[model samples]
Target: MTIQILSLRKKDLDKIIEIENESFVNSWTINDYINEMTHNPFAYYLKLIDKDSQEIMGFVGFYIMFEHAEISKIAIAKKYRGYKLSKLLLTDVIKRISLANCENITLEVRVSNIVAINLYQKLGFEIINTRKKYYPDGEDAYLMNKNLREED
Candidate 1:
């Protein structure tokens, strides 16, 4: 399947919500996504689309504040999970942030999420800390970070 990365559009919210619900236990509300995509100056949300079918395969969202950025969300459709789509979306996000001169990027993953943690680690992220009860369901989170300067 041919895949293309595009900016998130207002019309894509419903599909994105569906993917989010499948991907996370504490999924974001529609208003939360709307606020970020429509009004947040620092945020940039992107979608990975299947070019031929026009279906959303995955998405990644982030916010850049001066020199630092935080990945807010990332998810692939349930059927698309094993294809490394999350890795592709993350790679795109890193490239976009680097072009914007971001110095650091960080994200939180559930402590029990080994697959995600391994992906981040493979992409050069380091486990920097842990947030107590970071998730709505009281799951602790591992805070991972990648500093752009280290790669250079």
Candidate 2:
């Protein structure tokens, strides 16, 4: 299946919410997403859609501050697992940020999320620190970082 990456639109919120619910137990509310799209200057959200099925396969959201980008959320549909969708999203995000002249990129992933942690590592992010009970449900988080200078 061919996947298309596009800037997220207002109409894609419900499908994105479905993917978010399927991917995370601690999902963001619809209003949180709506607010991010409107109020956040640093934010850029991308939706991955299957060209044939025409359904949203996944999404990646991030924000760019002065000289850095912070990954906010990434989730793929449960049925669409085992593909390199996350890699594509991350690489796309990194590439976009570089073009925008960002210096660093970071994200916090639950320490127990080995799959995601591994993916981030493979994408050049290094563990910088850990946050205790970061999740509302008390799960700890690992703060990962990647500097664009290293990509040079």
Best by lDDT, which number? 2
lDDT (0 to 1) per candidate:
0.91, 0.92
Q: Give one digit per residue, the lDDT tens place, for model 1 in 39-114.
A: 8999988999999999999998899999999998888898998998888889888888888898999999999999
lDDT of 2 by residue, 66-149 (tens): 788899999889998779898998899899989888889999999999999999999999999999999999999999999997
TM-score to true structure, per model:
0.96, 0.96
How close is each model in CA RMSD to the real structure?
Answer: 1.0, 1.0
Q: What is the lDDT of residue 94 in candidate 2?
A: 92
